[model samples]
Target chain A: SIIRILEERTEPKRDLEGKKVLVTAGPTQETIDPVRFFTNHSSGKMGYAVAEAAAKRGADVTLVSGPSQLTTPFGVKRIDVTSAQDMLDQVLIVYGEQDIVIKAAAVADYRPVQTFDSKVKKQDGNLSIEMERTTDILLTLGQRKQHQFLVGFAAETNDAVAYGKGKLERKHLDAICVNTVGKTGAGFQSDTNEVIYLNREGKEQHLPSDTKKQIAHRILDEIVEDMEADRK
Target chain B: SIIRILEERTEPKRDLEGKKVLVTAGPTQETIDPVRFFTNHSSGKMGYAVAEAAAKRGADVTLVSGPSQLTTPFGVKRIDVTSAQDMLDQVLIVYGEQDIVIKAAAVADYRPVQTFDSKVKKQDGNLSIEMERTTDILLTLGQRKQHQFLVGFAAETNDAVAYGKGKLERKHLDAICVNTVGKTGAGFQSDTNEVIYLNREGKEQHLPSDTKKQIAHRILDEIVEDMEADRK
Candidate 1:
């Protein structure tokens, strides 16, 4: 009974004790009007799992989330946002304080150039919405990096590894998790995921299909390992 | 204790016994690519409530719903659909046998002209998506109606009642429920709603702000009353 109690006590490793972590989750909405919008298929499971895992490991987690039905993880401070611009603002406000920043959110690349205050009435003809790019939040954080270990997520349909590797270098991220979407039991709304964890140092770890919770902890382990190696 | 037990046993009104009813709920999503989509702000709460209430009143209810997080109400058959076209197809499949049909879904007025099989790569400069109007499901139903008592919902930003009345006449609907969007405790994702009911004979009933469940029961009452009046 004593041995079982000890095993239970040590099962949770607080390796991230006193560390500050910021995780972003869900797909940011780009409003077309008061009632309609454009969005991706992100369900925020991966990012929420990461936030929960980080908090369990004694990290101070600040989760910047877009519109999702997920509840806030215990012991994590969550900032709720709607559009891509709103998410960027909140993330930037707390960017400097985070020791590690994981951009797991599938932020919108484009938004309608003109957003109406009232609901747009359907008319006789086809409606073409001219779109402009949202400010790249990850790129901004990468450009302004000082001591923070930055991480990014690449949800790809093709050339997954190559795209992720490119993002890691271009965004100056410490690592990027690449996951191919449009597959069964992987990516988007699925609870399970398979990802290629690629770092700036050209090291790649292939994580086979697993629940997002397990994948999140493994990703954290890699992050800690990479940070320690850099210190040496 | 005996009085409370007796009240519970006799409380439910089964006025819709053996009646066939079909209710459509939520916002239909029109896809642009593998990941991104266009959608409106219909939460399907109002529709789900209607289905639940109808089923409780002894109606054989079939709910054709778009993408929503809400659970299917007990004793109601639910068919989930994504795009506006999909919802239309599903609704029409069961339209023939229903005595009452309620079009509560916020079907997209427009969809991308071309839906890509793969994810669209982000490129330089602004991107413009050419859109086309989706098939008007209610109009089609109206044209094909036989003995069905059709009801439509109009979610408007301006002239809610006028738009609803126009839809009632144009769609040949027995009744139309109009609710203004972009308001507090009403429309879209709100659990509570206030709606104005208008019928073909120019009868109008304004239902003040109330829980969607209560509103649903009241709307059903109006539908039954109007149907009986027509019979007389």
Candidate 2:
């Protein structure tokens, strides 16, 4: 909807028409047991925003998501997953083929060393959760890139921009959006977001706090511009 | 219901009549942000089992719990809590007034050092959750004991008996129940449990796996026995 409203005010270049785009969203639930999990679920808002924006711009979008209550946006291909392993499994299935990939998911970094299929009892003093790191999805994608532009999102409470730039280079991302959360209407479940978008050449685009829908279009517009420039 | 169904063959002890008892249950939810939390809600099945059994035996029972889908058993006073801090706050309020306190809740040992009141964005790289130890509710209650008896639980995966004994000594608990979870139909969300009912003297009474309701009665039977022994 934002894309439709935005197109009327600007020339429609159809920049992303029929391009294959892959997006990831939501937080992985590391299972401790049937009912208990190790970490929080990422609300799929930001990933959904990006995916919706891409779809609106006529991209063939494949959205790999973690468990969430949010409905899939119109005209987006959605694949739901449960754990970090599940997300990874789903992601690798489509990795070699996308024109662009945006990793907006709050991928859980660690999962219990082993997930007990059933209930786990509390040992008297404390029951320990042995954690191990999950595979870095974005880094893997960057390494295996073959004509695809990769974008990643960074969320932080402090030192957002500095760390974001560091990751941009380390992950070899084409562009990265650094989101500093904690202010009203920013991060998590809120409809609005404020982000600092940066490119490989160190150009920064600071987006003011606004609804996710509006922010989505701005992010897509930048990516399209860079894509067009690279084509020339 | 177990009590009602089991009453067909035995005399009701009403052993806990007129005694003030408090029990803690469920998992503590550590808030990472407004919409996200760390860890699962302790099922509170075992705690509810104990509280309900006490009420059936005529004890003035108070049940402090974390977020759960289970309903409150009849005649038990229930106070719901969210985090470890909240559980401690609730426990302290009734600690001095109770004749017996059972620390059965699966209390979280660590919580995020800083919790954002709003949503937290995912940093592109691994987002870290800095954790710090929470207050030991059982140990604090044990230290503040005057004329009251304190019971603590130890749930462990390995060497449960050894760990339970260690905590019983460390917490100065009058009685302790060591639960061995990870077995089928045992621990969280299950209706059944198996435990070792023990005391300060190192005496242990083994309880076979049974419905939590049945186990609750067995646990209380031991407590009542110990209480009578102390009075004599």
Candidate 3:
């Protein structure tokens, strides 16, 4: 099936023998106590798939992952982090050298204002934890981004497209992939993803649902094509 | 983080306790042969998170899942399937009985025109496989839907909002989640997601980087609020 799709892909496979691709995956864990933490449901499948796809194309791939049970794809470097701050720090270390950067991790938006050394015992009374906002990784990357291509994700439930467009403008991304959460099978941990590709030029391409591997291929294909067009 | 987010949620919990919710997840595998098949990277994380969130709020949840490695969330009735046709059949069977349907699975837009029972050996240097379009599940549901709230996902790489809005109208969805690919830390398998909720009324709400679970809760909150407003 892969061979068949490869054969049918009209776009020529762009060689990335020496290109460096960096990706982030999984959900960051924000600690609330020694025994408890805050996190998301990300399984790091999409980011790992992207890394694998990049490796398949002969690119040097580095994947910075959060907490997830999935194994690393073959021929890719993996780094694990637990919090959004940690993820941001790791990304900064490699961001400068990469030719491409894809952020697929669902970093926590906020963290416990104070981490308790011990877990709070459950009592009959109610308990509360104050939260503080985490850093904006996309915006920060966009601010520091150089010649490298940057892509961002906008997961929307309502007016998905409009908000995605806003992000594209605000983040100064080369392309953005929008997924609607309102749909049952398309986003998050689903093995299949159906997405539309939006480029900086406002061109739109809709990718039908397929495996993350195939979707990753198509996404990279678009990125390579966009790069080639930029070069021209 | 779950308890913190739940406490912080602007809307009350239990709002969807009795609400009948339907969700779809994972990628439909298209068979090329008995030994090989085609699928995507969707792990069904986002949809599953939403299902779990709805269940937490006491909704009667029915999750229609495609192939995925993740375990089913507790208290959520699960139905597994492969291929787009199987998904369509399940959705049609269950959608009518539900009050809300979230189409999150990345349904395949195309499938193999022919499925060979035996593996096709690499006999010739080149082989061609015919392709055919799968059913448009969202559109079909939208057409027959009466009082049920429908949501669709627009995964775009370009013109994210315009395309998303187009999909919302085309599918007659109450709302749509738009997500862009190639971002640093959101979408697909990542646990943390950043999305904008877009409603039919053109109102957009931005959700910064957070866990898919939190995002799911926010989405459900909005949906419940919208439903409440409609009743008023």
Candidate 4:
């Protein structure tokens, strides 16, 4: 506990004071039935850190999270959601009022087309489950952006920055944070992250391997800098 | 903490002194790809309780667990596992030395036929996952059992008793514990359970809604009783 506290950014910036921020985190579960579901490897750690950092810096943070074991960060409002659709519904309800939005969640791209009422009993021979696309939360948020500073995260296995830039342009996001997954100690479920923050203005900042908490603070600093430049 | 401590069985029984007990707990995850997986709703609470109770009763316990957040009970040896196949391998390695074995983990009945090396990129159309049956750990154990008192757990939505009995007979288990899922306060992820413990000798015991810890003790008591009778 002491080491974790020490590892965290101790000096609060208060730079985001009075700002309304919303962040979505964790991996959404798509239920196949009462007993079974499909899920991904997002651990919600990075997003939780961001929410905590923002809250500590005096921003009113609302964390719309999927199923996660992490405790609620103090002073941050949290809304728990299960499926990707459920998350989108909640995020949309509060989207208009937020000054900043971060889509850090690894939402399921597909969900089972048919969810059974009861546990599907084991049948003879092989089984096949039909799945369809879930609504893209970030894309919807980007399309509807008015004054909100929207940011998206792209976790890729290869050509991370290129894919992230493509997502940034396609989703109409102000900025996108790109990170390589499948690397040891750098992605999903890890405390450390190696990220490249790229903005619409072609500004790129590479943050080397660091604690997620520290990285969150640095990312916020970049967002603040970009917002200030846009105002001028 | 005080409330939980007060609710647990306080008196320690040495009824299982020097006996070797092995328990399998939690929900096994079957990876569909690097990012996505299929899993059930088993929280491993019941199995962990059984392990804790067994250890407290002076038994040497080995807890072979799937992905669970619960901590290992005092004096219990824990072996973490992921998929159903991994669980089976770990269990079979130590099965012969165990005096009692409890199948409490909700091992996935099916697994994806193919797992991709990397994350499966989203396509324009819907996706269908082909799945095949996983080996039944309990059935395999029963077929190879020597002096071990084998027990199995059946969590079902309908005809729980009948299904559990059939499993007991078909698997050649010494006893089977059946509990109805989808109830408000019982079965998966719940601290309380309403169980029907049935043995091969046609003896039936109804354990009303109670904390998993207390129910575990009762089940052990029944096993001990039956075991003593056999000795006579």
Question: How would you encode candidate 3's per-residue C-alpha lDDT over A76-187 as one tens digit per residue?
Answer: 9998888899999999999999999988787766666787643333233224445677788888999999987998876655676787788888888989887665333235
> Model 4, range B1-232, lDDT digits (tens) per residue?
9967865646788899989999999999999877889998899999999999999999999999999999999999999999999999999999999999999999999999998877778887799999999999999999999999999999888899999999999999999999989832226878988799999999889998899998999999998998898789
**Model 1 lDDT per residue over A1-232, tens place:** 9966774586777989999999999999998878888998899999999999899889999999998999998999999998999999999999998899999999999999998877888888898989999999999999999999999999888899999998899999999999999733136999998889999889999999988988999999999999999999
**CAPRI tier of model 4:** medium
Top candidate by lDDT: 4
DockQ of the candidate models in sequence: 0.62, 0.12, 0.01, 0.63
Q: Once superposed on the true structure, which residue ranges of model 1 sit more than 4 Å away at CA?
A: A1-10, A183-186, B1-10, B183-186
Q: Chain A of candidate 3 scores what in TM-score? A: 0.91
Interface RMSD value for candidate 4, one decimal?
A: 2.5
TM-scores, chain B, all models: 0.94, 0.94, 0.92, 0.95
The full ranking of all candidates by DockQ, starting with the best, is 4, 1, 2, 3
Error of 4 at A149 (Å): 0.8
Give one digit per residue, the lDDT tens place, for model 3 in B139-185. Answer: 99999989999987765545677878888888889998877643222
**Candidate 1 local lDDT, B1-232, one digit each (tens):** 9965784587678999999999999999999988899998789999999999999999999999998999999999999999999999999999999999999999999999999878898988899999999999999999999999999999888899988988899888999999988632136888899999999999889999998988999999999999999999
Number of the predicted model whose DockQ against the real structure is largest: 4
TM-score for each predicted model, relative to the true structure: 0.95, 0.60, 0.50, 0.96
Q: What lDDT score belongs to each candidate, Candidate 1 first?
A: 0.92, 0.82, 0.78, 0.92
Better TM-score candidate (2, 3):
2
Q: Write the per-residue lDDT of candidate 4 for residues A42-153, one digit (tens) a residue.
A: 9999999999989988999999999999999999999999999999999999999999999899999999999987788998789999999999999999899999999999
